[model samples]
Each structure stands twice: as structure tokens, then as C-alpha cells.
Target: MQVYCTKQHANNGSNRFCTQCGEPLPLAVGQVIDNRYQIIRQLGQGGFGRTYLAEDKNQFHQTCVLKEFAPQVKEPQDLQKAKELFEREANVLKKLQHPQIPRFHTSLQVKLGNKDFFLLVQDYVDGDDYSQLLEQRQSHGKTFSEEEVTTLLRQILPVLSYIHSLDVVHRDISPDNLILRSSDHLPMLIDFGGVKQLPASQGFWFTKLAGNHTLLGKKGYAPEEQLRQGKVYLNSDLYSLAVTILVLLTGKEPQKLYDSYQGLWYWGKEINVSPQLEAVLKKMLAYKPSDRYQTAEQILKNLPLLTATKPPTTHLTKLKTMIVAPGRQRANALVSKFHNKTQAVAKSIPLPVWIRPFAVSLGGTALVVLTGAGTWAVVNAVIRSVTSITIPSISLPEIPQLPNPLGQPVSDKGTKDNTQIISRRQQLEIPEVFFIKMVDELFYTSKPELKGRSLTSKAEDTALRNEWYDVASNFLDKLEQANLSTATRQKLGNYRSQDYEIWRRQARAGQLGNYTISQLNKDTNEKFDRLFPGQQRGKLNQQTFGQIWYAIAADQVSKLKSSN
Candidate 1:
């Protein structure tokens, strides 16, 4: 990594100790704060303070970073100012949630031997700063594509939009503050320490003698207003943004262009550029901030106008005609459409022999010949019968009474009595299992559609009705292992009222089988298994069980009984 400054340059340059106070720098790795954040490594050190990548630990919590006031360069006359700036940066960070902007979580002080102060914790970003990106591209003799430039501008302009909405101007906009992902090439803006708010007046601002010529911003790109302690607004940053884009496109620094033109920052011919784009860039680099856009939003509105011009090629004109002209011509379109439809029909026609028409004619002639032969045979038989004499009359005997049904007669009354007794016994047995199965059937009524319903005549007994409904549902589940018919299953279901009675009645009798019906009012695991017997093979809900059970009992009980 780049060493921003040795701990010694604490105030201005480089050194292991704080430069102002000459106190030993307290910045280090693995320091804990508020019993939460653990410092990882120093990210960078600036005039304000040192920033460290840290991990947050609520309980040895997690990895993150905290940027806090640098160990005060002892007796630096501007310590109070530095401290205010640090807190403000933290405050601005805490208020923002833009993805392009880093997130600030909390503030706290770390106390060690006669000292304590806060370290600002922020979400870590994982990409090279824009300057490194530029250098990497230059190393390979490459430049960003128009699409790539457009993408970078679009990603961060929204951040600018948001910043502008808050009435704050990010006075600094340059390569180092923009991060382009090494993987996807998406851009994000970082570092808001340079922001200045627009005041209540038409053109009020906060300005100072800024820039150490360090990488926060570059020379020629910074508007004169910012360079000379003059009031600046959104336009000031837009100028730098335009310059940055131009540099990315042409791979030439704005200062080189300005120096080549005797300190005129505008791009005319100092940078190898297209006339169309250079014209737009000239307005941005025009020295006076007012001569450029008034806001980033205005810049965004005008970006689409910088599109690449078409080449003056006769060949392209001919190709465009071939592709687009036919679609517009009625005659050519008819020919193209006809050819497609005919080709489709040719593919669908079946083999000729299977569909030949003559076979039906041959079958019709064969049937006619067979009918003629049958008619001749019948005519001959009629002649022979008419020629023959009539025979004497004879009477056929009637069938004797069928053997007394199995040679025994039953007394109808006696049969009726036996059947009645058998029927009553069967009715009870039938209902026993049917009621149980009814419970199983009731479960389906617990469908999502019926979740909160309680549509019964006995509304006052909704609780009781639901109670038994649950018992029935659970009981039917346990009854599965019992070797019983559909009727028995239904009986178990219908018997929830019986089980509820039993449950409330005994409050003592536990298990009729592997599970006790009382579990419906007991713990979740038992109730869940009964409500959903195959639950072990499905998902378990520790928290939702009671709610799910109540829903089931309320909606599904009546429907299941009706089905039974």
C-alpha cells in the first residue's frame, strides 16, 4: 500500500511521532474502542487525522474501519479547527446511505493512559482509488471507452445529485475520490471531508486557502473560485468533473493542456480530442465557474449531447439501405412474406400415398357385390318355404315354479329385525373411523385462504371450537400409526370434542398412543407433530407454531367435519 505519511509527519510531513505536539503517535493496529471496534491498519493520514481500517466488535464483533482525529500534533495552533472538521466529516458520513458514499455506523472514544478520543468507524470500500486506476491504464497504453466514461459519470453523478439536494457542495471532485471496481468497472465516490454547504444568501459559501497540490484534487481542473478563496457552488465541482472525464477520454492531464496554451485550461488543441467533445470540454474548462454549468444536474442533462459523430462513409449508407429499405417497401415485403409462408406449408404436407383417394372407391364396389349375393340367397329360401306344406299345431309347456329359492323360504319380518340390529352396530363403527378421518380431512381447510376465518354458528365458542379442532387434527396425525380404516381416521377427527372433553376432563390421562392429546395445550414439539405428523421430514418453526396452530383450528375444523 502507499504510505500516506510516516507517523512522524503527524502534523504535516512524515515521522513516527505526532508532528504538532511531538507526542508518540497512538495510531496502531488491533486497538479496541467502546468495546466494539478493533483497529486494523491505518488507511491514510491527512492534516485532519489518521484513518484506520477496523473491525467492529460487539463481542469481538466484525471487520470495519475507524477514522478518528489524528493524535494531536501537539500545540498545532489549529487543533480545534482540525477537531471540528473531523467531527463534521463523521457527522456527514453518519447521515448518508448512498451506495456510492461510504456508511458511518457509530462514534466513540478510546481511552488509554491519560488520553481518550473518538475513532470514526465507516464501511470499508474495496477498490483502487481513481489515480491508481489512471496509472494502471497508462501503464498499459490504454484509455477508457466512451461507454466506460459514460458509466463512471452516471454512477457518481447521482451521488452528486444527492449531495446537491442536501445543499452541500463537494468542493473537491477529482480522480482520487472516484473508485472504479477492478471487476465490474462500476464507479463509487469516496471521501466527503471537502464538502462546503451553500449558505442562505444567493451565492454564499465557505472558502479557504486550500490544496497542498496533494491528490485530493488536481491543479488545472480546480476552478479559480476554489483556488482563490472565492465563493463556489455546484458549478465549481462540475468543472473538475468535466476535466476528469476529458482526461479519462484523451489520457492527457488538464494542466498539460493549460500549460501548452500558456495557462489557458480550456481544451482546444492542447489535447488530441474530437472537435465535438472538445467544444463541450472548452465550456467546462473555461476558467470562470459561471461560464460553465450551474449544477451537476445541468451537466447530466447535457451529457447525452456529447455522442460520437458518424463517419462519412458511402459503404455504411449502402448497408443501411439493404437492412432498413426493404422493411419500408411494400413490394419487397410481400415477396419476403410469401416465401416464408410457402416454405412453412411445404414442410407440413404429409407423404402422398397415405392420403391417396382411389382406395375408398375400390372398397365401395366390393360391398355392392356382397349385398347382391345375399339378396339372391334369401329369394331362393323364400320360394322353398312357400312351396312346402304347413305342419300340425303344437302347445309348448310352461316353465315350472323355480325351486323354492334355495329350497327354503324366509319370514320377511324376521329378516327385517336382524338387519336392523346389524345396521345399528355398523353405524357406530362407521362413524368411529369416519370421524377420525374427518379430522385428517379438516387439516386441508387450514389452507392460506382460510387462515383467519371463524365461520361457525357458535361464535361465542370460537375458542372451544378451535381447541377441539386442534385436538382432532393432532389426534388424526397420531392415529396414522394405528391400523384403522378411513372411517376410524374420520372418527378420530370428529372426536376432537371428545378428546377436548377428555383433555379437560381428566387433565391427568396422558397417552392413548405415542403422543398425548394434552400436548395440544402443552409444548410445541408435541402439538406440532400431532398437527403435522410428517413434520420431522419437513421444516420446523419454533416461533410460528402457536400462531400456525391457532390458524389451523380456526379455519379448517368445520370444513373437515363436513367432508367426513
Candidate 2:
């Protein structure tokens, strides 16, 4: 096992000192910590401790990131206090659940040689951070476009909104902490080591925790209040995010863009953007916390052309807390809430078999109609578990008679002619909400425990494959029947095909199941939250589950572009 010393000299695992420099090595490759994670190499170091890339041997040897907590405190009591505070903060960090944020697994306390080390384990995100991406662009004599930065802000602000609503401040939102995930080409927020939680009800706990005076956050990116007083507000992250955008836009470091003597930002001279975006960025970079946009949602609302981008499904609000139960009770609760909410607009709409999970299932038949324009509709059928528990055998339901929204006669194939459908659709001016729901519901389904269980027989596998094919066919048939505009039809059809192909591929690999609708939105968003929270200026607004559909589709498009 190779280990590097402070002077960058390599040494053997058993060697205490480097053969050339005689510097001590804290850890070595192949060293297992806490009998689970095996260190691969050192990633980096900061004021607190170093980061290491490791693999969890117990979990199929999955790669993960390990952050060590080695604070510089002389007194033993101070070190103990710091460790206690770190553990408490880790507990809070564990609650963060978002696709863009790395999942915090657990914390550990272990001894290496004579020192006690605390470590936090998290899922390893494979991607280059924005800082690194900027350097790559600089090598090509280019910088991030205003459109790219605008897209970045629009995507990441919702993440900030999610965490900030839970009363947790990232405290660090620089380009270095924002990674562009390779899997989806979406900007992922990483490195929560500097997160600060300021729960209003736990004032005393916060006071004691804040007494550490660790001075978190980067020097140039952090706002004045955070750097000087060690105080963090939700908007503190916004201030740092704006700085990052300027850095990416100008291809200049933060210090170069700012005039320290005059206490002003002169990044505008380096690059130009739209007046609306410039105004939003300027407001976000305000020196004083109160003078800036208060929350991430504020910045999202004021962002130029955000409303024109897509459906009104922005998830910038606080989610209502929900309880997750098992069996029919859980299924009923989810379907009941969605049924009542969408009843007004969704009149006895015969939902296709594939999207039945997004509507209310009456015995064997599923019927649904959505109410609010942006409301996410959920429908779950109570499929009794198979007694053998080997492979689920869900019998496909027949397609019901179609209800012509145009009140036109349907042909034998269960669809009006394209001319009639388009003419009537134009007269009514109906948006593609149904199409959006169809694509988005694919991801909202729950995952059944199929781990370590293979199909009992090849016949069962073939049966499941046929079921998936039938579902895809039904989806295409539904799209054809809708006769949407060519652009909408192709976009939604591609999404459905993308998802269907993935499931089919998983089946070929012996990893497919008849999963039901997930009660927790698969933990994407909080359940039972009001679909709409009004259009107040500064308040948070909830995003419908349907929004995830487009977000995924957009991500797929981005990845395709990157690959090209």
C-alpha cells in the first residue's frame, strides 16, 4: 500500500516516516478504517481535516467519499467539544435528501495510531466541479455562457430552496462545491462539511454550537456577516452563488473581479448579460444580508424568462411532513389526497393502464381527472402480494373506451382523426398536462425489494418482458390517440421510450419488477403538501411531482449534448 507524506514523498503502508523526507504519513492506501471503508487515496485537505476516496467493502465494494474531522485545538476538552458538535451536525446532514446533493450515509469514530479521527461517509459523486469545469474552459480561451450560468442558477436554486426550507444553511456555495454530475449533466451540490443549522426552536443548541468560531466559508465568496460575525442566513448561500456565477462568467478569480479598496464588484466590465439577469445577480451579490434576495425562491422568481421556460411546476416551497406506512393503508392515503385535489378538472378520465398508478384505481378499473394546472396526480392500485413472493404476477387490464374531449366520434382504433383532434385542441387551448403526467409518473413509482431474488423460472421473466412491451405499446397508442402537436408528441414519446427501454434493459439483466406507486414520491418531495401556495413575493411555493418529469427529460437532453 502506497502513502504520500507531507513533502509528497511516497512510503510503504507499514512505514511510519517517508524514506526520503522523513515526514509522517497519516494514512495509506489499502488501510481499512472502522473495518468497513478501505482508503484508496487522499483527495484533499482543509482547515478541519483531509478527504479520502474509499470503497465500502461490506456493500458490494461501492465507492464512497470519507471526510475526516481533525480540528486544530490544543486542549483536549476543546477537541472533545468540537467532535460532539460535528456529530450533531452530521445527524442534521443525514436528513438532506435531494437528487443533486450527495447522500450522507453515516459517521464514524476510530483511532489511527495515537490520534482519534472522526469521519463522515457519503455517496461518491463522479463528476468535475464547476471550478474544474471553468479551468477546462479557460484552457480553450472560453468562459461559461450567460445561458449556461442562467441554467445553472435555475437548476441549483431549487436545491438551495430545499435545504434552506429545512432551516439548514449550506454556508458554502462556491464553484468548488458545485459539481456537474456526469450521469445526468446536472449541477450537484456537494461538500456539506461547512453546513450550519439554525433552527428557531433550538436557540440554545445553536448558540453553543456557534461558539466554536470555526470561520467556515471561502474568503472572497462569503458575505460580510458570515465572514466577520460567523453568522449565516439562508441568503448567505445566495451571495456566494452569485460570486461563483461571476467567476464562471468572467474567467477571473473573485479577488480580480472585486475592488477591495472601494468595496465594489467590477465583473460587469469583463462580461455582459441581459439587464434582467444582471439585476438579479447584482441583488443576489448585495453586501448586506438584509439588502439581498432573502431566499433561493426569490432569485428563481426574479430570474429572466423563467416563467416562459416550461410548465408552472416550480418546487420552491416548504413541503408538508408526512408519515410513511405499509400495505393498503399507505396506498389509500396517497390516492385519496390526489383524488380529492384533481377531481374538479379530471372528470372520469379513462387513464391508460401504464399511467394508472398516477390516478385513482376503482377495483380493477382506474379512472382519474386532474384539477389544478400544476397539481401532481397520484393513483395506486392495491395489487395483492404474490404468495410465493418470487415474481409478481400482475395481469394487464384491458384498455377502456376513450372519452372524446372534442365530443367527436372515435374511430374503431379508439382515436379521432388528427385533424379533428388538433382543431378542437386549438379551440380549447389545452396544455400537455396529461402528456407530462404520463412521462413523469414513470419515476414516481416505488421500488419493491427484489434484491437477492432471481426469477423462479424463465417463463416468469418472459411474462414480465411481455408486460413491459404491452405497457410501452399502450403508451404509444395513447400518444397517437391524443394527436398532440408534432413537437410535443415527439418530446413526450422520446421520454416514454427512454424510460421504457431502461426498464426493458433492466429486465434483460434479470432486474425488473411490478412496482407500485411510491407513497413518498420516492422521497423526491415531501408528501401531502398543498399543490399551490399562492403567488406571494417572498414565500415558498411547492412543485408538482410532474415537474420531476421535465427535469429528467431536460437532464437526458443535456447528457446527450455533452456526449456529442
Best by lDDT: 2
lDDT of 1 by residue, 1-564 (tens): 111123323242224344354433545344566666666545665544556766665734444657654333334444445455556666666667665566777766555544445466777664456665565456446655554454355456666767766665666778877864321223567766663333223121122223432223346667766666555666677787877887776677766556644656544464655554556556766676668766555555555321233211011111000111100000100000012211121111121231222121243452110000000000001001111001111111110111111111122322112223223323333222122223322432333343333222123534433443454435434434332432222222122222244233222322122344334334433444564566431222211222233223322332232232
Worst 10 residues of 1 by lDDT: 370-379
Error of 2 at 14 (Å): 4.3
Off by over 4 Å in 2: 1-3, 9-26, 71-75, 195-214, 306-564
Clashing pairs in 2: 317-541, 342-371, 346-369, 346-370, 358-379, 359-379
Please give the TM-score that candidate 2 achieves against the real structure: 0.51
Tens-place lDDT digits, model 2, residues 1-564:
344565556566566545784333566556799999988656666544567878798998777889876543446776676677888778777888876689999999876755566788998765557776676566446677665677677668878888877787878789889986533345789877674333323221111223325467888999888888878888988999999999998988889888889998884586577788889988998888889999777787787653333333211110111111111110100111122221122112223333333433456764332211112222233122222111112111111111112111122243323333333322332223232223222212222343222221133344432333243234445434533333233232112223333333333433223321231123212221222112121221111122223233333332332343
Provide TM-scores for the models. Answer: 0.46, 0.51
Under the 3 Å rule for N, CA and C atoms, how many clashes does model 1 have?
38
